[model samples]
Target: MEQLSNNYGEFAHFPEKVIQFGEGNFMRGFVDWQLQQMNKQGLFNGSAVVVQPISQGLGKMLKEQDYLYTVILEGLLDGKTVNTSEIISTVNRVLNPYEEWQEYLALAEDENLEIILSNTTEAGIAYDESDALNDTPPKSFPAKLTALLYKRYQLQKPGFTIIPCELIDRNGEKLLAIIQQYAEHWDLKADFKTWLTKENTFCCSLVDRIVPGYPRDRADELNEKHGYIDNLMVKAEPFMLWVIEGPQKIKEILPLQEAGLNVIVTDDMTPYRERKVHLLNGPHTAMVPLARLAGLETVEEVMLDADFSVFVDDLFARELIPMLDLPEAELAAYAEQIKERFKNPFVRHELSSIALNSVSKFQARLLPILLRFYDTKNSLPLGITAALAALIVSYLQEAGNDDAEVLALFAEAKELPTTEQVAFLLAQTKLWGQDLTEVAPLVDTVNDLVQKIHEVGTRAVIKEIHQQAE
Candidate 1:
C-alpha cells in the first residue's frame, strides 16, 4: 500500500478556534469528533489546539501527524452495526506546556479561542497551596489553569468560556472555585474574583463517550483494511453525550444541536448527570465482578452472553432502574440505550478500564441502590456484594488483564488479607465514610464471599451468585 501524506490528505481543515488541554482518547474521539461533524456542516468552522497537560503524552506524535487523526466510531445505531472512521482535522496544533509555557500562555490570548476543554482526570481538580503563581506550570491542573487565566487577564477581561470534561460533579464550577481560592491564597487583587464572577463563564459539563484509543496492536491489519495508513487512529463507540450546564450562548458556540445529536445545553444538569452515572455507569460497576467471574473479559461479551446478559438486564431494568427517580418508561428506554451502547462494535469497554476507581465508583453509582435495597428487603444485594468482593480482590493481586489503569487504581482499594479482614476494614467507617459492615449480615457475608472467591476462582464464585440471585 502506498503511504499517504502526514496530514491525512485534504480531510484536515477545520478552522483553528478551540483551545484544548489533555490530548487523550476521550477528547479526540468525543469532542474533536463532534467538532469534525460541525466543520463538515459549516456550522462550526473551528480548529483545536491541544496542550499536553502532563510531561509525557502523544502530543508530540499528534503534532508529527499535523494534528490530524482518525476517529473510528463503532456501535449499535438503531439496532445496526455502525462502524466507520473519518479523519478528524479540527486539531490545528498541539503544544507541550512543560516545554513551551510562554507559547501556551500566548495562545490563550487568541481572540478566536472561545472554548477551553479539559479532562485531566477526576483528581485533576485539586488545590495545592505550595503551587505558586510564578511556577512555570503549576503542579495541579487548577493551578496551571489559574496561571494561564491570569496571563490572559493581563490582556482582556476574561472571555474564554471554560468547560471541564472531568468526571467530578459540577467540574467547571469546582475548577473555577479552586482557581479563586488560589487567587486569594496568593493575595491577588479582588478585581480578579469579580472578573471571574461576571466577565468569564465556567459551565459544568458531563461528557460521556468510551474512547478505547490507539489501536496499536490492530494497526497493521486496520491499515491494510482501510487501504490507508494513519498513525493516530482513535477507536471508540458511536454512542456519545455532552451535557453542558449553560444558557443560550453555548448553542451559539457549539453547533452540535444543529447536527441532531444528544448534546444538551441546560440550566440544570442533575437529571442528565443522574441518568448517565446511574443508568449507564452504575450497571457497569455492578456487573464487573459477576461478568469477570462468569469468564467474560469485555463488556460486549457480558452483554452478548445469554446468562450474563440476562443478569445485566435484570440488574438494570429490575433492581437498579426502580431506584432512579426518572419516569419508569423513560428510565427503561435509557437503560436499553445504555445496553446497546455497551455493545459497541468498534471499541471494547474492557472489564479492566471500568474497574478503575471501582470502590469510588460503587460509592457514587451503586451505594444508594444498595442502601435502598437493604432498607426495603432487610436483605442485601448478593450480586452487588460479589462484585464488590471481586473489586477488592483485583486490588489485592495483579491476577487479571495487563491493564495499566487498573494497576494504578490498585492502591485506592480497601486493604485486607481475607474476606473477613475486608469486613473488618469496612467496619472502620473511615474508608467508605460509613459503617456499612455494621449492617445486618453485610460484613460477614462480604468476608465469606471474599474468602470463597479467593479459594476457588471468579467463575465458580459467580455461578453460586447466579444460583442465589435466582
Candidate 2:
C-alpha cells in the first residue's frame, strides 16, 4: 500500500497560520479535523505547523507521511449510525522542538501566523521554577512557549491569539501566567512583559470529543480497504464541541462557525462547562459502578438494557436537568446528544475505564449538582443518591484490591451492615470535603439503596425506579 500524502490526492498548501503545540491524537482528530472542515468551506485558508511538545512524540512519523492522514469518524449522528472518512490536509509540517529548536522559534517570525493552539495535556501548563530560558528547548511546555513568545516579542510583530485546549480550567490564562512567571524568573525586560500582556490575546477554550486514535485492532483491514498505509490514521466519535472564550474580534479572525461546526465563541464559558460536566461527565461517573454491578462492561451494553437506558434518561431529565441553570430545552437537546454519543456502537467505552479514581471523579463531577439540588429543592435527588450508594458499594466490594486509600477505608467496615457502612463512609470529610451526614437524609437514602442492592440487585432497583420515572 502507498503512503498517505499530497501525491495521493489534490491537496492545496496554504500559508502556515497556526502554530500548534501538540501533534497527538486529540489534536489530529478534533482540531485538525475541524481545520480541514474550515478549509473546505473556505472559512479558513491556512495550514498548521504542528510542534511536538514533549521530548519524544509522533513528529517523525507525521513528517514521514507529509503531515497527511485520514480521520475516521464513526458514531451515532441524529438517529443513525454514520461512518465517514476524510483526509486532513490542514497540517503543513511537523517539528520537534527538542531536535529543531531554532526552527520552532523561527515560527514566531512567520508573517502569516495568527493563532497559537496547544493540547499539551493537563499537566502541560504548569510553572517550572527551574526551567531556564537558555535551555535547549526548555524542560517544560510553558518555558518553551515563553522562549517562542519572547522571540516573537523581539520581532515587534503583532501578538498571536493563544488558545490552549488543555483540560485545566482557564488554560489560556494559566499558560500565560506561567509564561509571565518565566519572564520574571529569567529577568526578561519589562517591555517584553508589556508586549506579552498588552499585545497578546490569550483565550481560554473548552474542547469536547472522544478520539480513540490508531485503531490497532483493525489497522490492517483499514489499510487494505483504503489501499494505503496510514500510520497516523485517527478515529473519533461524531460528536465534537469547541467552546472558546475570546475577544469579539476573534469571531472575525477565525470564522469556524461558518462551517456549521459546533463551535461557540463566548465571553463566558462557565455555563457551558457546568452544563457539560453535569450532563455528560456527571452521568458518566454515575453510570460506572451501577453498570458494572449490573454485569455490563461497556457503555453500549448498558444502553442496550431497557431498564438501564431508562434509568440513564431519568438520571438526566429528572435529576440532573432540574439542577442546572441553563434553559430546559437546550439542556434536553444536549442531554439527548450525550445519550446518542454513549450509544455509538463503534466506541466501546468500558465502564471500568471510567471507574478509575471514581471517588474523586464523583466529587468533582457530580457533587456540585448534588449539593445544588439539595440547596434549591431542600431535598436530595434520588437518582444521584442511588448512584452515590452504588459507588460506595462498588468500592467496598473490591476494597483492599485496588487503591490503598480505598483499602484503608474498608479495613474495619467489611463486616458491618450496609447502613453502618454508609455512615462510616459519609463521615470521611477528606473524601466528600464535608460530612455528608449533615445533608439530612442523604446518608439514609444512600444506605437504603445500598441495602436494597445487596438484597435484590442493581438491575431490579433500576427497573423499579425507571418505572416510577415513567
Candidate 3:
C-alpha cells in the first residue's frame, strides 16, 4: 500500500553507462531487467539512461515512478512452475528527446556511456533522407542516432558499443549503413566517418522473450499483495535469451556474461537465429492449423489434450530436433522450455493468432525444416507431411489473400483424385517456392496424409499418427 519510489531506501544510483532508446514493454521487461540483475550481482556497475525515441512516449510515466517498476516473471523453470517478483531500479533517468533535445544530446558527451541499446521496433533501423540534424530530435531512429554520434564525435570521446535488439536480420550492420549514409548526406568530414567506423562497434543481437506488459487484469490483486502501487509493472515469462554477435572486445566492454545471465557473446549469431526459427517458430507454424482444426483454442489446450500433446512433442523431438545444428542436449533443453512456455497458464496464445499470414510464416519457418529433413535422410518427415496436409485442408476451408494463388492451384487439382492432388500441390512453384515433388516419395506421403485427414478429421488423424509413431 506504499507507493513505489527510490525514497523507499532500496534503490541506489550508479554511474550512467548505457543509453537505452526505447522505454517500451519489451525493453523494460527484458534489457532493463537484465541490467538490474547485473547491478544487483555487482558484476556490472552501471545504470541505463532511458531515451524515448518518439515524440509521445513513456517518459512522464517513468519519471513519476523514479524509473522503478516490478518485473513479474511467471512460467515454468526446469520442470517446476515459478511466479516471482523483483523490483528493477537500473534505469537512472528517462528523457524524451522531443521534449529535452539538449539533454538527449548531452548524453553522448557522457564519457562513461559504454553501451547504446535500442528496440524502437523493427522499422526503427531505417534510413530517412529527410531527417535533418537539427529537426527537433530528427525523424527516424538511425537519424537520431547519427546526430547523437556526431555530437559524441565533436567531444572526441570514445565510441560506445552499439547493440541493436531490433528484429531485423543483421540489425547492427543495417544501422551502421544508415549512419554512414547520414554522414555522407550531411557532408560531414572524412575523419568523422572514419571515427564512426573505426571507433564504434555495432553488434547484431538476437533477443528472445515474451513480455506481455502491464498485467492489467491482475493489477489490483498484484498491487494489494505487493503492498504498493506500481503503475509501470511489467509481466514476462521466465525464459530469456540475448545473443550478441561480437568478438572479444565487445564482450570485455559489456561483460554481462559475468553475471551468469543467459547472454551469448559470440562471433556468429546465425546458428542461434536458425535454431530459434527451426525449433520455436517452425513448430508453431506446423501445429497452428492442425490444432485449430481440432477445435483447440489456446496452446495450453493443445498441450493439455493428451493426443494432441504427444503429436506436438513428437513433432518437435523426433522430427524437428534432427534438423537443427545445435548440440543435442541443448536443443532438447530448449525444446522442453518451449513446451513449458506453450503450457503457461498466464499466457493464452490462440491458434488463430499464430495462423495470421501463415503462408509466409510457413515459407519462412516450416518450409526450411521440411526441406532440410528430406535432404538429410532422403525421406519426408511424417509430422511435417501431416502438418502440411492439415494446412492445405484448413486453407481450403477458409482462404486468405495470399492464399489465393495456392487456392487456385488447389482448384486446378479439385478434379483430380486426392492422390494426384498431392503431386499437383507439390509441383506448384508459387506455393512451396520450389517443386517439392522432386524430393523422393514426398508427394505420395503427403497424398496419403491428405486422404487420411479427410477420412478421420484433424484430431483423429493426430491420434492415429501418434499411435503409429508409438
The prediction achieving the highest TM-score against the true structure is 1
- Pick the winner on TM-score between candidates 2 and 3: 2
The CA lDDT at 346 in model 2 is: 91
Q: Which candidate number has the best lDDT? A: 2
Clash counts per candidate, in order, are: 3, 0, 2
TM-score of each candidate structure, all chains considered together: 0.87, 0.76, 0.72
Enumerate residue pairs that collide in model 3. 1-227, 1-228
Ranking by TM-score: 1, 2, 3
Superposed Cα deviation of residue 315, candidate 1 (Å): 2.1
**Candidate 2 Cα deviation (angstroms), residue 206:** 2.2
Tens-digit lDDT track of model 1 for 1-470 = 64434534566466567888888888888888898888888888888988887878888777766777788877776666877878778888888878888988897567788788998766567678899988888778888888877777777744788888877677888899999999998777787777776877899999888777777658898888777777878898777889999877889888799977789999999888878877787788888865766567788888788767766766775567776778999998888788777776566667866766565567667777788888887887776777777766666655343234344334444343443456555654433548787677877777788788878876676566667666
**What is the alpha-carbon lDDT of model 1 when measured against the actual structure?**
0.76
| Candidate 2 local lDDT, 300-323, one digit each (tens) | 888888888888888998889998
What candidate 1 gets wrong by more than 4 Å, as runs, is 1-8, 12-15, 293-295, 371-379, 399-443
In model 3, the runs with Cα more than 4 Å from the true position are: 281-302, 305-323, 326-333, 346-470
Candidate 1 C-alpha error for residue 84, in Å: 2.1
- Candidate 2, poorest ten consecutive residues by summed lDDT: 398-407
